[model samples]
Target: MRSRNSRLGTAAALAGLIAGTAMAGCSTTGMDASDTITIALAANPTGAFDPYRNREFGISEVAPFTHDSLLYKTPEGEFVSRLAATWKADNTSATFTLTPGITCADGSALTAKDVAAAINFASDAANASWAYGYYTPTAPLTAVGDDASRTVRVTVAQPYGYLLDTVGLLPILCAAGVKDPDSLANRSNGTGPYVVSAVSTGETIELKRRDDYAWGPDGTTVADAPATVVFRQIADETTAANLLLSGDVNIANVSGPNSDRVRAAGLDSADAYTAAAWLNFNQREGRATSDRRVREALVHALDFKEVIAVSTNTHGVAAEGLLVTEPAVCPTNAVAGVLPGQDLERAAKLLDEAGWVLGSDGKRVKDGVPLTLGLRYWTDRSELERPTAELLAARWKAIGVGIEPIGENVGGLVKTLYQTGNFDVYLLGWDLRLGSQFIPYLSGPLPPRGQNFMALDNPEYVKLSAEANATTPPQGCDLWGKAERAVVNDFDLVPISNRVTSLFYRGVTGQLTPVEPTSLRATQ
Candidate 1:
């Protein structure tokens, strides 16, 4: 756990890691007898293989190997060159020097033309993906200068503080895949470390090392290592952990009761964090939660620390804000003291003032209507969603409000929670790949326009989010912190925990393949 000061010092620390790359160089020669490394993923790719569109969390395990980006972020949170040789930027425009001779899997040359094409294709609104909101260019990002120059110029409508961070992701694809992404199901069209050699739909995904891949991050080549990689989907947590222990699976991500079992087994493990799990309130009309006071009451009624402890088996943090991931330009503790404490007296009073009064049936009522909330939670996403919802129902019941829990399946979570807007209260979360991914939710259009599931239409927030984007990091990112504070102050969002996923490894050589994919290589 690095401190704020250490986070500030990460640029230098990460530089040293990049500078001393040769000593840690990985080899592809020592082929294992099995010649493959198998990992147990949490779920199958629940959506289609459009690299630019909205997809499931399982995509994280697959995409990094198939698509290479211009830049890569070191685990310590600093930018390192990947396909790009050098980068220089200002508030409005940034330039990337595409490395000399990188090639896509089809043996075609990767050029500045390919980079510009991928950005333009994804930035189009008709793509119906999060990238539509993620990359908002007044004019599309284009390739500027001749062949010797080799630079892609990024121009935002205004100053975008996190532009550098955003470009580090987005999976830089060649023209072929961008033209016909559907045809990429069985082939390798990317410039990444591995090629998709085999796919069995939901059962398995296999990738073979790309021998010609020399353009990895931090001046290190990883494509030659670990002859083969395989991802196996095991829906049950206990079963996944057992597979790792029995050598049927080399690695597994375990949480709740299974995490303790993995740790007691004495296998290697590391900490992984994702987006903060939030209690999202649907502010649409015809819902009792449409009232601001009702939303605030729901926030304080639950015992959050205890709820997180019970749900995570004491392996979670009470999230102070949405930006819980570390080493960022914005101060991580900005929302520290803003969250409302769990106080039953305050919750009861707030509901009463909002015209919801206790009745003979023991539930609060407003104009003969009982104050009951329909709660939706993912049934298969985690071992904790149902229990967390049950605990919330119990706590809210003690405060005179009733909650009816509806279990949401994995394949239908997005449609059920965001599209239908059928639930008053729901348990939801996201993975903030570049930190600024949270912007779309604050500004509305719900699912299609953005992931504004709460249907928030805060003009001040919209203004602040835009203002934040118009500045560079440290300054612009600080504005984002202020906007998030405004969101928490209203109690429209209640964060229970910053999810902690523990990855256990048995025969995994060197660094384990991350829960969030990275440019890491095997030592064996």
Candidate 2:
């Protein structure tokens, strides 16, 4: 592993930062910052705008602007009504009161039946939703049109107490868009405040504000916004930050040393929490990390506090569980001290106990095989991911373990890490922009078929999760809390950083959360 070189761009960013700061104070601008909110994205969407098929992180960030959901949640996981003006549900079913007279981008009026069809589409077993397990209907979900009642009724074939939690985040689609999702690669038809005008792969997506749109969450409307919103894929974090500073772009999501440098340049910012970075151990046979003890030992080997400080620029804390930071459905401290502290001696002892003895090179070996872990991480993901991998390698090395760090682009991660099962341990982090309680990890599809990279098969977790899904409110959330604790406490996955970082932008009015996909932030 290469030595920790901070942010890879911050040191060189001094000049760019200075120039950016100086430029920010000037009014020599050409673009109408008031008429357009240009966002500098780290990467382009993988392709298309199909809610069922688009699992790319970049796309998730953009979907909300082009679609509406039955409900909404703040980044903190606080639930609120959305398309469904009033929703009431039981363990097995839900009924939604449709907002009167809302229209789709197609100029078609929305109905309760439309919302129900969306829920069914998203929950299909063949769907590619990242949270497929959470949204997958245990039984067929059906929608009944009841215009006289001014409501749409959806019945979950089986028990589903927390169905709305996952259902609420789904972007409701028109019948045509749902039938031919590929058509949305460059177009859209939804109830959102904007319609995707054009999609330039690897470059930009242009959106024009919907003058007819008036139904926002909680009966709100977009009173202040640019007539057009432009999303630019800059790829480089420093470049994005510099662009934002130079008024070339109004908003950008940047983190680590880059985030520090940009904010130091005096830009307005919004801090929002994202899911924690984590380590997923491949438990398939012949992989060294299959042993649970080894996983726990590795967790104990690193001083996460030190790693996080360098990685997040003090924007994060050591994570306790999957629900890292939250206005979450279930908030608890299951992670506090549940993990073994950074104790090399303890790690060494655990390795010794596990039959991995230190050899002449001071690296642990079992039988004739050395304990070398293959670590794969996303390339150019953030300023933190690469350095974090290096620091992690160093920490494990200090405890007589060997790790080979490999860099893969975001697109390559799913193929290499999950499909090919190419690595023993891989770096993964979920952006819980929409809270689904992470039920997929316990009972979702395994690699090649889905994103369950860990392949964790815990029956207790499944039972608890099932029970939780069939219950309501705090009861369901409370059960999920137990399941999360069970998996995490067993050291199935290692936590890295749980952070709330500020998105530095200009002329944006409403607050936004990195985790809530449907939370649209408009201009002031």
Candidate that would win on TM-score:
1
lDDT of 1 by residue, 1-524 (tens): 32110000000000000101221122223436335666666555544444675344213456666787788765577788888889887767778888888888888988787787777766665565555554443223443433567788776665665667765456776788788867665555778877777666556667777777778776667643666777666667787777767776666667777888888988887765543357788887788887889988888787777877866667777675666445544644434788777888899899999999988777999998888899887655566767888888898898889889888655566576556778898776543433355666665566665567787777766777667767776666668777777777776666667656666776655543233223343433
Clashes of each: 1, 3
TM-score of each: 0.86, 0.85
How does residue 205 of candidate 2 score in lDDT? 70
Which RMSD does model 1 reach against the true structure? 6.8
lDDT against true structure, model 1: 0.64
User: How do the residues 1-524 of candidate 2 rate in per-residue lDDT, one tens digit apiece?
Assistant: 01111111110000011112222233223645346666665555566666566555213456667788877766445667778788887777777787887888878877766666666666665665553554444445666757666687777777876667666566778767777777776677888887877666666677778876666767777655567767676668777777877777766667767778888888887665554357778877777777877988898888878877755668777665565434455655557767677887777888888999998888889998899999987664565668778888988888888889997765676577556878887776554311244666545677556556677776777778677767666766677767777777777766677655556776565554342222344443
| Stretches of candidate 2 exceeding 4 Å from the true structure | 1-30, 57-59, 74-81, 107-111, 134-140, 144-150, 433-436, 448-450, 476-478, 514-524
